[model samples]
Target chain A: MPSAPSDSLRLRVDVPDRVAPGDPVPITFRVHNVTDRTLTLYLMGRDIAFDVVVERTDGATVWRRLEGEVVQAILRLESLTPGEALVLEATWDQQSGAGSPVAPGEYRVRAELLTEGDPLLSPAAPLRIAPR
Target chain B: MKSMALSVRLLTAATVLVLAACQDAPQPLAPEVSAASVGADRASDALREVMALDRTVFGGQDAAGQLVIGVENAGVASGVRNVMERFGIAPSGYRIEITEPIHFATETLRTVHRPTRGGIQIHFSNYLCTLGFNVDHAGGRSFITNSHCTAQQGSIDGVAYYQPTSSTDPNPIAHEADDPAYFKGGECSRGKVCRYSDAARALYQTGIDSNAEIAKTTKGVNSGDLAVNGAFEVTSQDNSSTTFSGTVNKVGRTTGWTAGNVTDSCVTVNVSGSNIQLLCQTLVENASTQIVGSGDSGSPVFTTDGTNANLIGILWGGNSSGTLFVFSPFKAIQDELGTLNALTDGTGTGGSDGGGDGGGDCTPRGNSGNCH
Candidate 1:
């Protein structure tokens, strides 16, 4: 008989209460493995290549994946075993690469957790940033 | 008949000449009427000058006779003896009547009314509430008073008030680069930035003790008596101490210098006004020390010991109990003023505990134990 799959792959993200333009918005996520099996996960988002987010709270969803070249060597997290947790952090610069500056407003951040070979999106939590 | 007529004409001519001589010789001025009129005129003039003095000189009309006069610019008190000499009043000839230093009773009344150059009405609230005199220290940058009396942040003509607090390292905060020009004798305080009108300056000048000459003559002030260096005078001695025990003889700008007694010694008074709160301790057994009400925060406390009186404390604040009061020691005040270099000698050194000039030399008048 094959062993039962673990349902413990949980994800969490944290954001600041308020942010102003040109200010970095730091986003951190923690993934925990509840089962005895190993897990692999990847974090993807638009223009989200830095250790922190410095974007305006404009109502745009231009999600961009962060790359090693853009985030330097500071953007990597290895795999984790059962009963273990993997932490990944990134900074989103609002003024990076001369994109349209984000306007001041409330913003919601979405963090999706996935398992290797699995296409299902894990639980998502919403983080709100008040206008500065 | 012709000879007699000539003689009569000569007599008449002689009479006319005598009358002319009398008129030209300045007829001996009538002694009583002229003397009375001159005295009345002099008295009138003195009264007018006194009236013209700033009403705040000693807290208003209550201090009419108590306001000391000096020869300096105006508000400065030359010396007790010198003041007496100016009025032809002799300290030796008359008995000394030491009274409690004048203090205003409330902060609301301490506010001064003045007109600015711009024809704008500027209300000086914080500084006005804490105006009073004491020997200064602080390289002329600081003076001594109840720490609570000093504002955490004060302003004069929109300039930030500067003071040294334990929280600020290197102490004695300075104004910003764009701050307004510094005001000198026109207005001053240890705790807050006080403003003065032209009349206020004249009032201060009338009572200033710049040379410390009066300090030399002061006697019988105790270790913790409140002292000020501004306009004040000692008038007639009221033999009836019991009748006026708790009543203030002099009046000033705030509550009219009414009399009160040290209700408690070493009492603590907690004061809250203008969004500021502070606790101050009056002298030991100072229940009779004229615990300050509101505007009286900066009034000086003195005692009559010998031929002259001496300063003891600077009105600061009170404790929660309201029974206890607080004041700054004259010596400490002098040290602060000295730090400001405001003293004439530019010496930031603190004065002797004995009223800064051998004053406060009297034994406690009554057997009141620790009047707190």
Candidate 2:
């Protein structure tokens, strides 16, 4: 798993506790290179990818953010020196793969960074929506 | 009466608003620092200067997420700032802290002469350091400690080292043995690549019986009876023991035995005026008292499981307030010293235990039982 304080990497993600169905979901991650050498890591649109996953309490995947986007369209690389970190932020328009607003009910959602075939997933946070 | 009650409520609300405004407001948070300046560059610049300074200190991230340099004393602050200016870094970009000055007024742990880890101290011409791992290279028998311990300009051959006498004796048990067969010190663990450490080795006279254990005492700090199981195999294998979190321990001449957490693994630290990068370090902080003291230099750092122990690093120095203690990893010592014959008991062979390099194992000589 891509975790902070791994042999050479520290990946910490921040997910908000609550958000409306139609609002953009903000995702933030902090990546640190804890090794002694310089590191070239994938930033985006490549193997180093993040997924916004929404799942139900029954363990069913309700939605994925990168459902049909090009996985390799905007591949980016970030360089980090030892003890350096990068704070990357992105936002989701609260829409699912089907382009429909998610009906929230304490839905479990998280951010995952796929690195070196390891899925470093953030702790799932609750996205609540009132029946307005 | 209803109108009066309304008026009272309004007055109370107004008073609360006024009081709230009068309260000191917290300053806005600083903007996020860029990754390179705050991360690698700052860390890299912190290494050599800290080590050269010979003051025990570590580089850490401030709340602003920028690299802040911490020193052990005020004397080191100006020297560090001089280095900072070389990098075009402003004074505000760093922090100077004065922790306790280690290697000062000292006390004896136990009477020397035992195969124990404590009570044995290394003495230079005018300085003294606590002895660390009893190691040998090739066939020359020697011991390992911080490079700054024997900062002799030339050969330290035949330099006298000391051990405390007994509990009641005013004199030391062993004093003035100059057998400096070979000595090497490291100012930087890794030059510009990554983190490194400060280490030194001294080969002395043949008769003294030294072991791998640090002097165990029921005296200072985490004072108690303790044993060194073996060196951490970080130079050979990356195990759970070398993680950045969790408890780490050490036994020193000045501080006796104390425990602290492995907070920062990869960081730059200040020693006197020089900076030395540490790939893995444990910030030694005592629970209630000072974790380290003067004459604690070269003390062996270890981790224990109530019975067994694993060697990690050696005592270098610490801050005055005991807020920070810095150590050199066994792996770094091995990297600079080449082959070190670790002294387990008086019977140790002092051969290279593969000193924690890339999943290696210790030789049969390791007395701590497990090598990995």
Best by lDDT: 2
Q: Residue B18 in candidate 1 has what lDDT?
A: 18
- Model 1 TM-score is 0.25
True contacts kept of each: 0.00, 0.00
Model 2 regions lying over 4 Å from their true place: A1-132, B1-110, B116-119, B151-158, B165-195, B219-243, B274-280, B346-372
Residue A47 displacement in candidate 2 (angstroms)? 52
> What interface RMSD do all candidates show, one decimal each?
31.6, 24.1
Top-DockQ structure, candidate number: 2
Q: What's the residue-level lDDT of B329 in candidate 1?
A: 41
* TM-score of model number 2: 0.39
Candidate RMSDs in Å, in order, are 32.7, 25.2
Q: Which stretches in model 1 have alpha-carbon errors above 4 Å? A: A1-132, B1-127, B134-138, B141-230, B233-252, B267-269, B272-280, B283-293, B305-308, B318-326, B331-372
DockQ of 2: 0.01
Which 10 residues in a row give candidate 2 chain A its minimum summed lDDT?
A: A68-77
